[model samples]
Target: MFNESKKAMTAISQYCGNRVDYVQGGGGNTSYKFNDKLMAIKASGYTLADVQPEQGYVTVDYSKISRKYDEISKKMDIDVEAETLLINLDCVELLHGMKDLRPSVEVGFHSYLQKAVIHTHSVYSNLLCCSDEGRDNAKSIFENSKYGYIYIPFISPGYTLSIRVKDEVIAYKAENGKMPDLIFMESHGMIASNDDYETAIEIHETANQMMIDYFNSVEFPKAIIKKTSKGFSSKTEMINKFIVDFSADENYFDTVNIYPDQIVYLQNNLGKTILIDKDNASIEYIMSEKQAQTLEEVLLGVVYIITEIKRNELSLKLLCKEGEDFIRNWESEKYRASLVND
Candidate 1:
């Protein structure tokens, strides 16, 4: 029954995976819904680039998720007891071919979306999401956009964001007469979903193009580099606080926590880069001098992105404690990280 789905999904995954401009650090998830009963989602820590139609995804009973969210949604918006509310369900794995394989943490939102959904953390999308006028700019294009669009404020990927998306989707449909084809998540990524696989990919491409064009139409302040303490350089003072001299023995990145993708890429090369460690990561470093230099460039990119984030005065998403937990404990991501380009 899902033969076409497998073919479609495989085609789209491979198509998008091959583009580093779209799926970096395996930080995206794609899924194809097979009836309300099931969906095959890209497994956690797995790159869409490496996904084979039959071997990579975890089949999940998405209907079960909808039911659970419906029940929880009623009281979820209640602010008073939000902290005390308890809603727990057993580990529901109706069919995960590989026992250890977990679907993307984003599965919750995908289940609430269309039959086909592609979510990617493209740098182009971030140009709008992270710019000072990004939301306004994106909203302007969406106003005249050929496709129906929905914009979500920055909410990290989790049940909370999923529930929010579900609610917004319902509201959008009620007002616009159809579900959104393009859902732009602030400071995160964009989701392109449709009943047709090819259209989903098309919409993602189109939306990103719109964003790229929008950014091109506007001028951005260049990231100016100035000498800083301990042989570091940056455009922002807050971010510069974490960087220090390259150390042969100490992990300087330990004192700071950066974005999710940065954590993944810099894990092994912490020591060699002009260190700007944060969040007291305290993880061990294992990269050689060359690896450290390469990672330094990545960190510099991070610093520039972060500077833009601050310059926009946008509260872009950053990896929190929970996100840090996943990068450290998840073995699958560790392997993916070993190969992911920044």
Candidate 2:
């Protein structure tokens, strides 16, 4: 039995570590209930690669956290009950090893989960959460599927996200006669559950592959350059010249593959562009006519320059690489197609 649990932990680590889109850093977490009294969960700030059967994880008393929270909430006002429960239960100590390690901010949500749980920030999934088209695409993808899922709009992570999920699960169970098997957070990723560890992982894998297959069928426009100048100019010449003069490197002068929304921005007049920052503040950028070339060039250049300038970096090389990757494998294009077909 001990060996089986260790193998399960190892398998969970391998699954999460292999997918860059699912977890780049220590961004997601997994857990399994050992029994009614105990649970084993991935430790905080440690990459899945670092997790083994013996290192940097915790076997906490599940009943303790639940019981303490229940007791504290009863004595506290409703408005402050959750907060009081978290502190009084000593939830912070549940994170084993590394005294400084903080339990996952989503612990509250995890506490209410069943036997096994898997949370991920998969790129394809989160992209679907970012816009209306993506949301609808997700709904249709799982509409009649055997694995039931719940979708929640954008909400802050940690306490707020947990509360929202808990409330949604309760309402869903009341209306549908069952709790969701999976949960999708808008602009975030997903949480899946099953009574068995392997089953939970399989469910996540099945859903992930379905999404990948859907994206592979999408057709994005190939990068093409055409020159209207009546002088001695070829398509390649125009494209090369455009890259040399505008971009940081000629090698990076690739294609201008824009999504529907990006096309709108590219076709807009050349001048200052408005963008929203992480803090929700508006920022403006002034672009010269030289900066905006062919529609594709404009699209690539604008994105490259924006990221570069924001990071105060010397070059936009990485930004260009990201754009190339997006054109080659972007799920947004598939999502856009899904919307049109719907």
Candidate 3:
């Protein structure tokens, strides 16, 4: 069972992992359900590109997780995060022997989805999802497409997010007679789930392209990062221009933030990764090459989303203060960031 899932995880990771625009750092989770009882998902703090056919994922009793969601839904005043984490821990298949690994915090929602699920914090999706009219624009963008779509407003990640998504998915299935293939979460990102790996990838690609075409948006500008003795520096025209313009504003990144990954990778740590020398109009990274690269991608992505949103005259939909705080304190996100920053 793990064999088939491992193959599928590797395939999907190879397909999207290295695409910086699709995911930066360890910001995405991919999963494959081997059957009704067991499913394999990416481990916490690991980048998709880091996944191989034989490693980088863990198998869990998804059926148990799905059942637990149903049980929790009936109860009142439950500690959603604590309850969900314990449930996921209990459902882990110890026989497989990845004991130290933790399933993605999103396991609850994945358990109820199709066999193959790819969730990405894609910049293309954020162009629409990070705008005030995101849901309405999404409806019009994918309106005539073959895939069924659902929109979830911004919410807390982990158990709270998963439960909300579960409700929406269940309601969608009831009315449409099938689960939705495309899910667009406001101030979050997009999810493409299907019965197989190829179709899931297809749905994700097609939907992102649809959003791109809808906005008549150009491709993101190249992020030119050059290594230096101290670390790395940004040479891209767009990025340097952004730095020159917004360097004076200390909270600029937080203001332009369009999604959770922006918070996790940029805003929270501030100048730890990329150092902005406002006096000289220079930006330098003081972290590892991989961490520097991740910061560069995220920095450029945030700038790109802001540019496109402003060009289209759509009101920016920044992550709320509550949302920002939640992500700031999330243990799972901290672990993921630690891996990149280490």
lDDT of 2 by residue, 183-204 (tens): 8875457887877778888888
Per-residue lDDT of candidate 1, residues 307-339 (tens digit): 545554665455457757755665445645654
> In model 3, which regions exceed 4 Å deviation?
73-78, 94-99, 245-250, 278-280
Query: Best candidate, TM-score-wise?
Result: 3
Q: What lDDT does candidate 3 reach at residue 297? A: 86
TM-score result, candidate 1: 0.68
- In candidate 3, residue 21 scores what lDDT? 80
Question: lDDT score, residue 121, model 2?
Answer: 64
Give the residue spans of candidate 2 off by over 4 A: 1-3, 66-89, 92-101, 217-342
How do all models score by TM-score?
0.68, 0.57, 0.92
